[model samples]
Target chain A: MYKQNITKTPKAAALAICAFLALVTAACLLCLWHTGRSSGQLTAEVYLDGELLWRIPLDQVETPYTLEVPGPQGCCNRIEVRPGSIGVVWADCPDKLCVKQGFIDRPVLPIACLPNRLVIRLCPAKDSSASHAAPDAVTY
Target chain B: METKKLTFLALCATLSLALYAAESALPPLAPIPGFKLGLSNIVTLLLLRRYRPRDAALVLAVRILLSALLFGQPLSLLYSLAGGLASFAAMCLSGSILQKKLPLLIGAMGGLAHNGGQLLTALAVTATPGVLAYLPFLLPAGILTGMFTGLCAWLADRYLPRGPSS
Candidate 1:
């Protein structure tokens, strides 16, 4: 079978591999560009399941505090919120991936605990009225 | 299946499972969640190259199921299933078209598909679009790790003694 199917040239294989790599690299760049762009103000939003559990303005935090988020079947994640950053300090889940993620002050990536079904993300803080009026409208 | 063929595939499954367990015992490669070396895929790639895709799938299924039962939560099983199936599909498609050569490319494609599958599962399970931000970070990671595993498979396929033909 191997001998019968040596039809593809080595040059063609190399070109295909290069093309695939380039395509994925371009996509990675685009995604980074979209997520890395920072707005003037940032708000950290904590989510349990899909619902918005809490929205804290990262820029306005003067003191550090921790919040315990409980999920189904007694799973929990303890979040540490500092002046300008947030992270999961503790989690009851088997894999402490969230805690290992450390802290984030920017809106680039989200901290997620899959076992606990918890997600913490940063978004551009909107006006008080707009944010208050539609808490669920926050995009990611 | 012949007894000899079955035994060889079973041995492959065990080796892959060992690889999976060993990889998991190590510290997380990166701070980002869902980042992994996926070293066990080396076995899957080798199987696809040397045997039938069905044989490869059987071994993969066994590894995923047994590994999850031994060392993972219920939710992790879901993620593994999605990623494993998607990875297998990508490898089969690429291996068929590209033949035995260019395992690197095939492995990279499998890695990308695996992450994409897990990301989609995360989206559904968590119901948060914010997790999509992980896409940029995961894509590059998948490519690099996938290529590494693929190279390992290529080396193994080249040096290992030829077994009974499927």
Candidate 2:
């Protein structure tokens, strides 16, 4: 009888799923805000899909450069670039696993998807300390 | 009675092994380890329907060990054990709380409990508190997968005829 009375329609399930996703999105935004407060300078340019989309001069500021690339609109996989690194910030991929993956600041941290044909990277200035690690990159 | 119990255990083991092998051959889901549907759960559903809790427990222990051996992923036995045991416990507990027709909820609870158990084990193994941040993300995944596996079980129970004894 408990099972008979337990009304679990798909609509209710879908609503619950939507609510969970909203919570996750809010959490991600909260993390970004937390990181943004202690931000560093942007001293580089980012390229995606073989195009020069963003440029940041080291002397300009000490804030992380955040850029959004234009592509298939509404998709999150557009490349994101900060002073010290670059990565794909958003993609319309089904999994959204890339979005779940936050920024990568290491020189060797590369985020890519062969199926989407997307690539992102941070190019350091010629005179900047190559000894230091690259800037941040967020793959969506 | 012993002969019948042994036969059921053997069948469950075979099912678990087949599913484990199939899953092992597939590439990792993303880069994270130990994230999957645990398709061998088909056996769990079957047991929940056809056998008693004690029988279900025996099947779970045997399946986890046999699957771990088959895959050579012995290091993952701790994870599997924690997840499997938690899942079984949850299923048994929820079975009494819910109904025979509500196996999906049982499956979902089992999945959620299993992931929680796995996360606990991961913390112990890796000695990294940062990894626990992944727990919230996995919760919804567990519920979703649990619902799916539970649905499969529900279908099995619904369409299949009751045993002669019943």
Candidate 3:
């Protein structure tokens, strides 16, 4: 039926969209890993679809840092890390709005990129301290 | 035909400029870029039917410059000029080739062209190729808004007795 064909195409588009979104989500999740275990250095990894793209050391970095990465296919920020790890300091995208966002190192907080559909979250890693007195990153 | 067409173009330009100014009184639908009723297009579509390509282009030029003055933003000048010219050209070309009275098709093409032009201008201004990702995001909205504006223009053309026949 004509309807069947029509439905099939949307499914494909949806699948494509889903796949793209999943990649962004994975990137977000990957950027959230914890790299500190009493070493004073906080390490963060950036990924795309399970592929490791970056490993950064945030240890002894009491001040914020800015990391600019190249944007992906869509007009999206690549990555940025601000001084606080609380600010966005990474982005390859031209806008650099995300990178300008500054550091947001709290475990509960997150950063987002609309174009590349990428996101970065800060969460406790395997080596994460069970109960650090510091605030967890939380994004509203 | 020449004098009549010139008069018509001048009239459309003036009318659209006035409307453009008046529309500013209304609040924005959203804070995002490229959201408006584009009411000035009513004159553009009207001129399309009654005049030639050259005359229609003149109307577009006058309207764009006058509106830019009223809006007063050199930063947005590139976007407005490019978008307005592209949409006008699209409407003119499509009207000539398709030779169809169907307003919807004309409107759709105009909307698509406008968005393309805006995106191009944005890319140029920001010097960032990444903004292309937002193009897909804008298409559906452009189509819907284009159809609505086209319908308005069509209705105005059909029901509102011709304005003095130039």
Candidate 4:
């Protein structure tokens, strides 16, 4: 019967899907693994609509502090900065996704809010000691 | 089109819209902008198997447009439309590749494309290249959520009634 042929192919289809799912899962894990968890010193930079709003050296800050950054159309986000890390603790944006993102303690992908046009990125602290050296590192 | 087909399309569209609205009410699953369960695709996958491609596409478009009007911000609308179209195309291709037999692959591929589309839109709109870093997180979220939705659709397909041809 025609149905028999159709039935025979399902196993192969299921197997292919399983393989594909495994591949996607593995790729996801690999991506997370590569997020590059850079610990130690970090600099927290907040950008509003591509403009630098605030820069805090996490290494220098002794006390945890919070500030409000204004956005277009009366929107705003509240940022909390600690000695070694920073995060968006509150936002007036309807999605509230930035606040949900919580604190980022390491150098990884920035926490972004498309609606608020806000971004919080943590980068490895620059070496001020190398400021005067026009050395081999500058040419590469 | 026959009344039966039209009715089915309407029902699917309504189901999709319900899913869209329900999902909107939920808190963000992750911090990523475009990451969501994409549960509405369950209806899309089911329609793709039972009807012509055009019919399925019409339902999807209607759902996206109507949902945009009902509960979406302009920026979100833009992102959703971009992601919806990209994911729709991916699902269509994957559906054919899987011979409409495996909804999970279609869903997973659709999810991947959706994240890709949103990323491209985010990059273009903000002119910020750094957002590309989100790819690592979004890809996995899309695949996992897409597979879940696809699995649900596949099960529904087994028990749900097809068109009159059945």
Best by DockQ: 1
lDDT of each: 0.83, 0.62, 0.60, 0.78
Per model, kept true contacts as a fraction are 0.36, 0.00, 0.00, 0.31
Model 4 residue B39 CA deviation (Å) reads: 1.3
The residue-by-residue lDDT of candidate 4 on B1-166, one tens digit each, is: 7887678788889999999889888988765556789889888888888777898899998998898888876677788788888988988877876678778778888888888888888778866566676677888788888888889898989998665541
Error of 4 at A2 (Å): 11
User: By TM-score, who's the top model here?
Assistant: 1
For residues B88-108, what per-residue lDDT tens digits would candidate 1 score against the true structure? Answer: 998888777676678998899
The lowest-lDDT stretch of 10 consecutive residues in candidate 4 chain B is B126-135
lDDT, candidate 3, equals 0.60
Between prediction 1 and prediction 2, the one with superior lDDT is 1
Model 2 C-alpha RMSD to native: 9.4
TM-score of chain A of each: 0.69, 0.39, 0.40, 0.66
RMSD of each candidate?
8.5, 9.4, 15.3, 9.3
Candidate 4: clashing pairs of residues: none
Query: Could you arrange the candidates by DockQ from highest to lowest?
Result: 1, 4, 2, 3
Model 1 pairs whose backbones collide: none
- State every prediction's TM-score relative to the real structure: 0.69, 0.62, 0.52, 0.67
By TM-score, the better pick of 1 and 4 is 1
